[model samples]
Target: MLTAFLRVFAGEGHPVVLFLDDLQWSDAPTLELLRRLVTTES
Candidate 1:
Protein backbone atom coordinates (compact mmCIF):
# COMPACT_ATOMS: atom_id res chain seq x y z
CA MET A 1 0.00 0.00 0.00
CA LEU A 2 2.75 2.41 0.91
CA THR A 3 4.84 1.46 -2.09
CA ALA A 4 1.91 2.05 -4.44
CA PHE A 5 1.36 5.42 -2.81
CA LEU A 6 5.04 6.30 -3.16
CA ARG A 7 5.10 5.22 -6.78
CA VAL A 8 2.06 7.30 -7.54
CA PHE A 9 3.48 10.27 -5.73
CA ALA A 10 6.75 9.95 -7.65
CA GLY A 11 4.97 9.56 -10.96
CA GLU A 12 2.92 12.68 -10.28
CA GLY A 13 6.06 14.66 -9.54
CA HIS A 14 4.67 15.71 -6.17
CA PRO A 15 6.33 15.66 -2.80
CA VAL A 16 4.75 13.39 -0.20
CA VAL A 17 4.39 13.85 3.52
CA LEU A 18 3.54 10.50 4.96
CA PHE A 19 2.01 10.40 8.41
CA LEU A 20 1.81 6.84 9.49
CA ASP A 21 -0.75 6.52 12.26
CA ASP A 22 0.55 3.33 13.83
CA LEU A 23 4.01 2.66 12.57
CA GLN A 24 4.60 0.00 15.19
CA TRP A 25 1.78 -2.03 13.66
CA SER A 26 3.49 -2.11 10.29
CA ASP A 27 5.12 -5.29 9.12
CA ALA A 28 8.90 -5.56 8.83
CA PRO A 29 8.88 -5.75 5.03
CA THR A 30 6.69 -2.68 4.74
CA LEU A 31 8.97 -0.72 7.00
CA GLU A 32 12.01 -1.94 5.13
CA LEU A 33 10.43 -1.00 1.81
CA LEU A 34 9.75 2.51 3.10
CA ARG A 35 13.34 2.78 4.21
CA ARG A 36 14.48 1.82 0.74
CA LEU A 37 12.07 4.30 -0.79
CA VAL A 38 13.62 7.10 1.19
CA THR A 39 17.19 6.09 0.35
CA THR A 40 16.66 5.21 -3.31
CA GLU A 41 15.34 7.12 -6.29
CA SER A 42 11.96 6.51 -7.82
Candidate 2:
Protein backbone atom coordinates (compact mmCIF):
# COMPACT_ATOMS: atom_id res chain seq x y z
CA MET A 1 0.00 0.00 0.00
CA LEU A 2 2.80 2.43 0.85
CA THR A 3 4.72 1.55 -2.32
CA ALA A 4 1.70 2.27 -4.42
CA PHE A 5 1.11 5.58 -2.64
CA LEU A 6 4.69 6.87 -3.01
CA ARG A 7 4.98 5.60 -6.60
CA VAL A 8 2.31 8.10 -7.56
CA PHE A 9 4.82 10.97 -7.34
CA ALA A 10 7.94 9.06 -8.39
CA GLY A 11 7.89 10.39 -11.97
CA GLU A 12 5.81 13.56 -11.89
CA GLY A 13 8.61 15.90 -12.89
CA HIS A 14 8.37 17.83 -9.63
CA PRO A 15 9.61 17.72 -6.07
CA VAL A 16 7.41 16.15 -3.44
CA VAL A 17 7.95 16.65 0.24
CA LEU A 18 5.77 14.84 2.68
CA PHE A 19 5.40 16.53 6.03
CA LEU A 20 4.42 13.90 8.45
CA ASP A 21 2.96 15.60 11.48
CA ASP A 22 3.12 14.09 14.96
CA LEU A 23 5.64 11.51 13.87
CA GLN A 24 6.45 10.66 17.47
CA TRP A 25 2.90 9.48 17.88
CA SER A 26 2.95 7.21 14.89
CA ASP A 27 2.98 3.45 15.26
CA ALA A 28 5.85 1.15 14.41
CA PRO A 29 4.21 -0.08 11.20
CA THR A 30 3.77 3.49 9.99
CA LEU A 31 7.41 4.34 10.67
CA GLU A 32 8.50 1.23 8.86
CA LEU A 33 6.38 2.21 5.89
CA LEU A 34 8.05 5.63 5.73
CA ARG A 35 11.47 4.04 5.95
CA ARG A 36 10.68 1.84 3.00
CA LEU A 37 9.39 4.81 1.04
CA VAL A 38 12.56 6.81 1.52
CA THR A 39 14.99 3.96 0.86
CA THR A 40 13.25 2.53 -2.22
CA GLU A 41 13.10 5.60 -4.43
CA SER A 42 14.09 5.18 -8.05
Residue-pair clashes per prediction, in order, are: 0, 0
Query: Candidate 1 — which residues are off by over 4 angstroms?
Result: 1-13
Candidate 1 deviation (Cα RMSD): 3.3
Best by lDDT: 2
> lDDT per residue, candidate 2, 5-34, as tens digits?
667776658656788899989999998988
Model number with the top TM-score: 2
- Candidate 1, residues 1-42, lDDT tens digits: the string is 666667775665577777768888999988898798788766
**Candidate 2's C-alpha lDDT?**
0.79
Candidate 1 similarity to native, TM-score: 0.51
Cα RMSD, each candidate: 3.3, 1.9
* Candidate 1, poorest ten consecutive residues by summed lDDT: 4-13
Candidate 2 lands at a TM-score of 0.66
Q: What lDDT would each prediction earn against the true structure?
A: 0.75, 0.79
